[model samples]
Target chain A: MKNGIWVSKNGRVSEASGLQPRDALLFAPHGMTSEDLLQEQRSALQQNIKLIRTRLAEATRR
Target chain B: MAKARVFISSVNEDGLKPLRRSVFRVLEGLGHEPLMWEENLGPWPSYQNPVEKCLEAVEQSDLYLLFIGTRGGTFDAAAGVTVTHSEFIRAVDKGKTVLVWADAETKAIFFSGIAWKLDEYIAHTVQESGSYPAPMQALDFLRSCQEAPPHIDPYVWLLLHDIRQRGIYVEDLARGVETDWRGYFSDLLRRGLLLLPLEPTIAENSNRLEEAETSFDLLAALLPQVTLEPPHDWKVWLNTIRERLQGRTIEHRYGRWNRETVGSYEACNAASLYRRDGDSMRFISCCGRASAVRSFALNDQSSYIALTYAMGPRAEQVYYTESGQKFFYCVRSGPFVATFHFPAGSSWDQLRYIRYKDSVVSAIIGPNTRLVKLVRLLLGGMRA
Candidate 1:
């Protein structure tokens, strides 16, 4: 059987059947592709950066 | 005149202590009678009919003050019929003046409840600065009302008076002005007019009518601007709202994915831009374990989008983004797939630019991997 991943409805991640433990270990089951995860992380990081910049601007104004 | 009666309703016992005391003191100071369930109820009545008495108190009161706490009981919980909820309903049913106050914490908790959620009461819930003791907040609400001159309920009165003052007459109000002109004229009638023993001549009535007409003209010009401007330019409208709400001291932040992120060459390589139009943009991005897709409009009006994954669980949020942008994203647990949708009024060229960026990122990560090939095909279709 092809090794796959499974993500539970509540966002829990689990490995699918037939994959090697190593490959399974590398994969996450929450149904998010690796690319999607990276993009979301980047989006969050950018938001944090904006927040920090806004805070700094406010501090400087004060 | 008889003292005004007030009913106070709250969910939290611990938080109610100080607020209860403060409300009691303030109302007493203002020569009013203040009633609270915990302080005034002799005991939870054995008879179910006791609820009727509570409703009666609410009906008799000049004002009903609802104190919404951060936590009390679930709406679906057996204790869901909280005093606050009951009093609110009773006050509404009886057509009493009801005031509602809640803080952010309470709002979150209140909204989460299944039974009587905050959204059900949003029209009545007045957002306060923070979770102060309920009684003190109640005192503040009372004092604010006292400071304002006796007028019709502010929101209603403002709408009615402003609409009349602006000269833009609704058919209903125009009829009211014609039939029982006395009822409409009473508000404009001054104390000076009443003091005269003799009835005013036609000239005096004409003068008053002219004054009202001028007032209406000023209101018609200004009120519509106040009502209409915000929907046209939402960004400026939101900023104005934020400014007015600064005293509430709650941070309201909204963010949008800019062209650099959405239209990057890297993004195009990783995602597929499925649809492009003047106001709508749609695309899908995929990686090893997950995929995300969405549709949104440039003008940020009503739009919906969804993403599902091959491996991981999917989640969805439907919300409007800053700058009138709206979209949705979903991801798989292991591989990466992301999709975006822009609606009929959005800038499709901007989406194309984002697809281009994603393509660049795919090239950098893996020159000709299967995932990269898939991304290339997706972007190539967009170009075609």
Candidate 2:
């Protein structure tokens, strides 16, 4: 059975082409400061909230 | 059970003697072969440098039991680290399974992990003493320590507390220790007696002196529990308790606790007599002249209280409550302080409570008994 994996960053998605410096910094394993990782997480959460809001608006209009 | 070579590591200081012994006994009871410097290594000068020998022992051992007490321990001047502290570092570096048991009072300081060495630990202590926030953790640790049970060996408990049910076991174990000091040194030492001619280590003589001092202190603490002159308000409190216990039958009797050996003398004390209810269900409270005997009594009392609450009518929460200026508690096989427990399916916070007082009497009475004399001698010697 394939073990389920938790993807914290997009590194697993594109192994052929390495991530950009900014993306690398955002997804750095240990070197990136705690604040940087937290900021990245916060941004991802904000994007999720925006997408959820858009879907809700469309459902309400329909 | 899979066997492991477990090394018990602690400073040979007075305060930690009880804990070190308890841990050693428990490990052996759990079927682990326990090795300790005191038992395994020969006394001072036999090994040119004992600390290196201890480290080599730790390297060979599979499990390390490290007990941290109040004092950092005697300085190892050559290594510039406390002996116990250095042993802990070496044990950790060697990739052994390290189980660190610390006094609740010192847990915070240990948890900080700030001081890698004893000198730093001492400096940290001084700085913490002068500060507010740092000392807060230490104070909390002390308050918690009071609520925790004294670390005692299961075998020791079987001998001292469960003697009625396990008298034969105690006798057998005592017989084994009569000849072998390796397994039972601390138990015999703390009880205010010792069999001489065990090889003397550097710390052995000073440790014996301190144990004597502690015995005097603990005994002095314990004697006041059997009060012919109960505190002025004790009668009032007892009356209240008696009123609470109106339906329950209470009886009293004078008897001798089973004879045990202390320093070649077969010593027995007049057990303080008090029983509640019929023969089938009775609680015995004993008091005696020997301070060590009273400590055994106290141990038995605490264990009995814990067992009582455990057997029938499960308590939602159990704690020691203060009455007549002493600590009283009935708990289930563990240490608990004066706190209320809220159980389910009950309008009330607690179903039943156990009360025993004079908890702090030992802590208070024992130390002060000799500290004054020591202080006076120090002062006089200084002036001279």
Candidate 3:
């Protein structure tokens, strides 16, 4: 929450719950440079993948 | 390289957009986390006071980079000090890397009292003491903060670099002693362990040298007789070593309790291996004691691992336990040792334990130790 990205207690995005698309825009605010946008996009994609993995793990465990 | 979290305290409303932008860009280019009010603290929840949180951030930062301009900012009536002024003072009192970059013109503005305080600090104590680096302008000051001071020993430099990477604040390095590096270094010099020559070229050059080379030099100098490879996973190795000790039932010899032991031997002490400015490591606080133990154990265990790695792992591990007290391990590796000075324990108790362990270890490893029996006993106790 501090960094605009929702984080679990461990300061990481919870893998069991995928992040919403809107939340990924936290790092890519208006007037962001093209380079920053590219970096943010890459970061967002990674976060999405982590979230998906977490969801998969939770589902399997359940 | 560890990126220090730098808290930039400048008057946001002072109409210095270009300066702020350049500073931010420069900091980011140098691989630092620059925190400021505009991008950070505008959305504080109603329940929390933004001013207090801002001060807290200053205390927690590794470097306090203050840019004094014409604006005095708002005065907090309750605190009787300007917000920016208060933040600067807190940074100084807490013994952070207080770097002030005041424009030449800003000296006339006494409304905040920052300019005078900084001037006084530089003129009297800092200059007279001849130990601290005098305050400089923004660009020069920031660059100075980035460079290791000339007096730092090569070994200490490596220790600082490694521990700083782990986000330890310099103030917390020698916990329960001097929270700041200046004080700790002074103590080291007093003890004759660290020497400050007329020109400390070794440390100055050591800073630019490759990491592996610096580490190797430190190891060679400290443990010339013993060539020890750095452990790949230091914590796992320590745990393995601890297990070996436990399996051999070495704890019983030093312990007051019977062999049957219950409850966790979680680390009660959470001292940093090397404290630096603006290094904050957060632990998720759960409700229960067990959870707290896990949190602290992680902190202390990693700290001890880092310490051993930096100092080399020629160590002796001992466990002490009784019926009621928390069971703990004292690991004395190379020149460094860790004791159970838990947050819950009394200050007297912590100091006493540290002194006692230091004495015992110093005695056994004295330069003139001719008694093979004591050496064998200590080594045999460690072998398990």
Candidate 4:
């Protein structure tokens, strides 16, 4: 989730990412909107899913 | 999108009605199940406690998505907190991923310290009242309880303060006005896999969905997956057992061992039973009723009847046993003792199913259901 813009296929305004209140959350640094932190989360998910996919591919090949 | 059972928690308030409805629609659209607080719960018998039903849902969910509105929910006399908060605490205690969402505008105002001014006004309007039944440790909502003037939403401020002060992160507390909640939640569901507690299936599902190039492909992959119904009775809550095992806290839950109660109890066939110790009862009692004798055990120190016994474990006790080459990772509900048998060569989740002396897969190492494995796999190993 660290770096990338995401556009939804179903189309709601993806341009302005959703920001939860900064003071209200943790792991959220100053000067970054909550969406930026959420982006890191999304990015991590993509990577993990890729890891699992790679593993699955290996398993199937075996 | 990853499938998940989200236990949607909220007080019944007009402000939140639309959010609940829309969230349900969004969850369904994303191929996830939304366990609504009301309506979607319960197939319980009349005598069963409603709290058990809600707790049951909380137990079954992959995520505890909580919505704290501008008011307190219905207070449960037995539990002492609002039903919603009790469930919230249970989710926290249970180690579930709790995404606490409050009214963003109200949270901002509370953070701004307008709550002090609001309380000052409320200080004048305060009427004589008895204490609110709440644990000071969960929150010192005691001050809010005593001082709140009518008309102002005191609970949300008290709530924001309580949740924040207690170190519970309120980061996800965003809502409608500035954000498209649908997009927000859709992104949340699609990306929520990273936040799941720990399940073995996350890897399996990611692989299954990896080449799912189309929505049709995704549906084709998911179609054979089994949907697990909530346990009927006496089935060991594997999540609870795993957590308690880690925490080293002993606990027991008693249920009548009968035909209707065998939701996932592996010894449903009643294949074998252990001989009772002279000190232990041939019949057992467990922790539920007082001075009540029974065909089954339902109280503390109640003897455990396994395999061939007519009544199933009235109390759950955890232990690991040896069965030749493969270690039987068994959990008995009445007492606690164990050995580390997860030889490095074994995967904990795959080693979860155990074999009894009779060579049948018996009670609790974990359910041997294909549905359990499939759901866990598809769910991105949310909890193993």
Interface RMSD measured for model 1: 24.1
Task: Please tell me which predicted candidate would have the highest lDDT against the true structure.
Answer: 4
Give TM-scores for every candidate, taking all chains together and pairing residue i with residue i.
Answer: 0.26, 0.26, 0.27, 0.37
What is the lDDT ranking, best to worst? Answer: 4, 3, 1, 2
Greater-TM-score candidate between 1 and 3 = 3
lDDT of 3 by residue, A1-62 (tens): 12122212222222223332321111111122222333564466456555544434432342
DockQ of the candidate models in sequence: 0.02, 0.01, 0.01, 0.03
Which stretches in model 3 have alpha-carbon errors above 4 Å? A1-62, B108-384
Residue-level lDDT for A34 in candidate 2:
23
DockQ of 3: 0.01
User: If the candidates were sorted by their DockQ against the true structure, best first, what order would they fall in?
Assistant: 4, 1, 3, 2
Winner on DockQ between 3 and 4 is 4
Cα lDDT, model 1, residue B309? 31
lDDT of 2 at B353: 12
Stretches off by above 4 angstroms in model 1 are A1-62, B74-81, B108-384
RMSD of 3: 25.8
lDDT of each: 0.37, 0.36, 0.38, 0.44
Clashes of each: 83, 6, 12, 28
Q: Across residues B55-87, which tens digit of lDDT does each residue of candidate 4 receive?
A: 888987878887876778776656656777778
Displacement of the residue B100 alpha carbon in candidate 3, Å: 1.2
